[model samples]
Target: MAKQLLAVAEQKARQMGLACDIAIVDAGANLVAFHRMDHARIAGIEIAKGKAWTSVAMQMPTANLAQSALPGGPTYGINTTNQGRLTVLGGGIPLVRDGMIVGGIGVSGGTSAQDIEVATAAVQAFAAAHTHHSTGASRTIR
Candidate 1:
């Protein structure tokens, strides 16, 4: 899964001409794999890990937390409670299998949209691999 995720993300980032820092985390938010593309922003290293961790911890796409993490929002100070590991960014996605989160993927060093797209590639691949529906539909995918 890590190899496939890295290959897919690397290809996507290359096609888009953007360097990336990609990280994968297990269900417990433990780092499983990581890769930093040439010229990727140094800051992206930690951000990528945090994104994956945040996704697994929250069990949702990091983008979905953006609004809630804003000032005055219900989860406004949520970031402060995670020991500074929470990242409500656009590139983090939880990888679900059989209705449970199996892991997470995170991407950085690109625009928010690009980061999401890269992470989505990994999510899509994981979904396709675990497809259960006979009609080629994934039970845990969107």
Candidate 2:
């Protein structure tokens, strides 16, 4: 699962001319596989992993939490919660099976939009490879 997601993310990143660090984590928020493209920023290594972990732990895309978590917002200071392991970055996406998250994928070393693009592509790829039926809809908890 991680291998396919990494391949899909790497290919998508290259297509967009981005050097990304990608990470995958299970439902338990445990690390599974990780990859940092050549010339990728050193900071992306931990950032990507954190994104993946955050997605799995929160059961949603990290981007969804970004706005509300900002200072003065409803979830303000959430970034400081969980000992800073939780991030509100845009690169994290949960992998779902039967409407339940089985894992998550994260991509860093690019703009939030670019990271989302790569990570979304990886999720799409995973959905395609898996035999489980899906509605192909985005998950939102608002």
Candidate 3:
């Protein structure tokens, strides 16, 4: 499943002509698969992984991290105290199956919205493929 997701992410990045750093992490926040496009910012590699790690670790999207850590929120200083390992920006999403989180995906090197768009497309592609295979339904990817 992780491999399939990574393939979809890579294909989407190529299709969008966006150089990106994509990271997939298992439910335990461990790295599963990663691809860093040529010319992507070298510094974004670990940031991307940390975003994915936070998603898998918290079983929620990374965007929520920012909101949850607002000035008076319970998670204030989380991103700061974590030493650059946490980001409140978009690009990380949890992979869910049967109501259980299986892994997560994080994309970097683009705008926050662009990163989310690419990651969302990859997730949608994976879900569509999985649904077809599980239900014996056929569809063309063209």
| Whole-model lDDT per candidate | 0.89, 0.89, 0.79
Better of 2 and 3 by lDDT: 2
Candidate 2 collision pairs: none
Model 1, residue 124: distance off in Å is 0.3
In angstroms, give how far residue 81 of model 2 lies from its true place.
0.8
On the 0 to 100 scale, the lDDT of residue 15 in model 1 is 91
Worst 10 residues of 3 by lDDT: 133-142
Pick out the ten consecutive residues of candidate 1 with the lowest summed lDDT.
Answer: 133-142
Give the TM-score of each candidate. 0.90, 0.90, 0.83
Q: What local lDDT score does residue 46 receive in model 3, on the 0 to 100 scale? A: 83
Give per-residue CA lDDT, model 2, range 39-133, as digits (tens).
99999999999999999998889999888898889988888989999989899999987688999998998999899999999998787666443
Measured by TM-score, the strongest candidate is: 2
Off by over 4 Å in 1: 132-142
Compared to the true structure, candidate 1 yields what TM-score? Answer: 0.90
Report each candidate's C-alpha RMSD, comma-separated, in the order given. Answer: 3.8, 5.7, 3.4
